[model samples]
Target: MSTAVDDDLWSAVGDPTRRRMIDRLLADGTGTATSLSEQIPVTRQAIAKHLAVLDRAGLVHGATAGRERRYRVDEAQLARAVAQLNAVGSAWDSRLDRIKRIAETIQRTGGGSTAEPDTEHRNEKE
Candidate 1:
């Protein structure tokens, strides 16, 4: 995923209320408006609103169970989100590894300016 879109996905999931709602869905196989409302502090109306957001984000899918509607997590979308996070994490890990390698090389070489900032780009032949 592009970083901007990936970031937005995480931003939507970043809300504490939404996180709790996801936890509730994960723990329970499926939930209805009334069922979710009972577990959360919000009212049934508020739960519906949250559910709408989750649906738009592709985090949850709701089905009509007779007169009531039931909602469940969209595992595929969750997996996509997980994979995106893992990719970003892997990239950062590589960057850190390169930084450590540079430090080790400097220490082994015994450079005079141990912690000096990069000055090679500066014009030195005055």
Candidate 2:
């Protein structure tokens, strides 16, 4: 079962601003909300709000350092996101492989009718 954590992560990353903040943190290793705001067009308070969503999503975590809290990307959460994407890719690959095999069989037999004949490859090498 998928948890709310997944939803939050997806929602947080679904926005361009939040994604930019994440990218900034990744490129700079770690940064405060104010620092991220300076790199982007949003205000510091807006950046903080985006960071809050990221924090809830477990994509990022912040800690106190002197007078400000520093935010950093959580690699574990990123790994989970990558794994989910890879899973979808694997499923699509399997489906395409099945379609290819079926296509080859139909081409060889030449008697099948109306069975997804569109799988014929235009760019395939013989």
Best by lDDT: 2
lDDT of 1: 0.83
Clashes of 2: 0
Quote model 1's TM-score: 0.69
Computed on alpha carbons, the lDDT of every model, listed in order, comes to 0.83, 0.85
Candidate 2 stretches with Cα past 4 Å from truth are 1-5, 96-126
Candidate no. 2 TM-score: 0.68
Candidate 1 at residue 77, lDDT?
Answer: 82
TM per candidate: 0.69, 0.68
What tens-digit string does per-residue lDDT give for candidate 1 at 61-112? Answer: 9999998889999988877778877888889999999999998998899854
